[model samples]
Target: MFNHPQAERKLEIQPNCIGDHVRRETVAAIEVSGDHAARSHIPKITALTLQCRGGYTLEAELGISPNGYAEPDYLGWEVKQYGVRDFVNYLAKSPVTLMTPEPTGGLYREQGVEAFLRRYGYPDKSGKPGRINFGGIYANGRDFHADTGLKLVLEGFDADKGKITNVDGQIALIDRDDVVAASWGFRGVIGHWNRKHAKAVYVPSLMRAPPPEYAYGARVELCEGTDVLLLLGALASGAIYYDPGMKMERADTPAPVTKRRSQFRVRHNDLTTLYQASVHENIDP
Candidate 1:
């Protein structure tokens, strides 16, 4: 379909590179539509970790190394700033914390151990040091500066009052009846971050099943007999615990709205590095 050799040569030329000949304009490879853009701004719960202090500071790498490796074997630092006087002031002032390093915002910060014990502790039981005084917080995903609105929905655990209606491929387009179609996505990797872990694609149909062309880059092996119930019943919503090799951990119940709103969480076993005692409660609204 070439009209002239010169025109064919024009086609052969690579995209303009520099100077006046260069094109100043460009188009985005990915264009986000209106509702999608709104979803991006609306924060969801990404992950939740217990904070064990009156109100402490949280740096990215906050933990003690059991073996004393060069770097901290433990990541996600937490501190408890609860002195007797600190507690007194905290009761009136709220949480006592270092404003500089800045605590992880959107944290659900429970009271100091003593105060929390008195508040939530049982009258019949009297155990001061046996894991009694545990308060907690549920942080919004945006609090971690994470990608808000993006939540990994487990199939079974995360659902609203209504049954999910439509599922298309890896994306579950659920019509909760209360709202328009909300999209849910699914992918199964080996643990959280183990790329070498015989990873395969597992996407249940949200609408019409995507053709084989859907699994382009990755290997796709169809599970011929997998029931739709299995996909529907898996965990859904909450924060995804990004434990390096294992990125998804399940967590707390989401606020029940229809549409596409969501949260993410990872499983407990996946978070091997988490200190068993770490905890916190969110500041009250």
Candidate 2:
């Protein structure tokens, strides 16, 4: 909330609002309908049959794709990883200007976002008597990928202060069954944003293995550090807004670290506003 009539509209342009790119918080908030709910993985695979490759006839019969005999098997695909976005495509196309205003001297001066606003009049209030904080919007969009995905929920702890005994560079999150759970990488930081629906997020530097699709947890271990979920707040800790009615599969990664740490802190937006023809949230003021 700001006094300006256009401030709210500008904030909507941020990642938490609508755009072509994917964001976990936004995805969780959306009421996925029809084929989208059942088949979100189709975006990953396309044109396996018409690729013009010939070899294994048995692959097509056995439901495998050694050659270009059949279409991609969307059902057997892997989980979508983090940072697999086309954001750079948009940034590359954005215009660049030289007469951008330079911040006289302040935190804004170092970041250089003020220059853009002073150079190009923000979508509204042309040359208004104020500085535009463009970095806030940019950072919000970047965080969509920065602190997201299965890894976002992974946690780590201080070696000397926390209960990290194994120190073998990897650990499993499990109950009594001994089933392998979430995996933690070498060194990382688990950050939590200030939000009600937010989850404790793992800001890992290197994440190769992802949690199983629809899995509950993963046996998380790390070389740099580790952290386990607390019993008191465990059940509701990393509670994502996954639909109870949805046919969710058990996740593949481990979860002992964040069993009680909510991963996704989504701010549910009003879908009613989206349907309101006269009330435009993304109005170009």
Candidate 3:
């Protein structure tokens, strides 16, 4: 629980304005010296995956509830967590999974995810029988992925202007036969980013589990001034890349199980490049 009276005072004094309630709550959470249970209301965890529990646990501590919208997580701020070994030298060099937007156009959408997977996917590298997968790190100027035989392409954004030339522009995956394997449109992608991440915070955590638990670090990174144009420019320059993990299980069966995860990612060090300003502050202080 947080210091509610102080929060109430802040809210009363600054009605309709952004306040330090989130920061104060975050600091209060940091002061709770122990591991927390894996939890989140936004993405209610039916099964706790290794990569997901850290953020969920932190969200639980922050008292955030599920509100289904492409908007901020906390009082006007998107809260995200990244795992680290320790709080010391807390700037972990991990790739941040920015967003997982499904393809809006191309065979993936028009023909369906399963069809597109069978057409462009490779046999599961792990030798999981009757499984096929479509995944690779693809960026501008990169050649076709050897296994998947697909290359990434950006459609109508002019790199010189650092602005989208067409709202219909896309980040597309093209096959050898010139078929668009999958594509994400500019409008949806841009809207998702600008709305959810206009003001955002990244918290680092140390995690352990069988029953998952997490310990959040005091230091947090806050970023602001997000624009779709900055994201487009990063895609154009290869600083941000498309990395998908779409797969079909029991491919031989008529009703194959499918998992879809189309993601855009940037290095932790490169996070500031996507926003106008970014700063690190110790919540505990």
Off by over 4 Å in 1: 1-59, 62-168, 171-173, 176-180, 187-261, 266-285
Model 2 local distance difference test score: 0.20
What CA RMSD would candidate 3 show?
6.0
Tens-place lDDT digits, model 1, residues 1-285: 112211111111111222342232221111212121112333321111222321211111122222212221111112222222121121212222211110111111223223322333232234322233221222222222122112222332335642444332232211223121222233222111122111111111111112110000011111112222322332222222221111111111132111111222333222212111111211111
Highest-scoring model, lDDT: 3
Per-model C-alpha RMSD: 25.5, 26.1, 6.0
- TM-scores for the candidates: 0.17, 0.17, 0.83
Q: Between 1 and 3, whose TM-score is larger? A: 3
The model with the greatest TM-score is: 3
**lDDT of model 2 at position 128:** 30
Q: Model 2, stretches more than 4 Å misplaced?
A: 1-172, 175-179, 186-236, 240-281
Assess candidate 1 and give its TM-score to the true structure.
Answer: 0.17
Question: In terms of lDDT, which candidate is stronger, 1 or 3?
Answer: 3
lDDT of 2 by residue, 1-285 (tens): 012211211111111322333222321111212112122332322212322111111122223343322122223211111111122221111111101112132222344332322332122224432322111111111222221111122223233343433333332122123322233222221111111102111100111122211110111111111123221012123221111011111222231111111121211121111111111122122
lDDT of each: 0.21, 0.20, 0.73
Model 3 misplaced stretches (Cα beyond 4 Å): 1-51, 66-68
Q: Once model 3 is optimally superposed onto the true structure by TM-score, how far is the C-alpha of residue 132 displaced, in angstroms?
A: 0.8
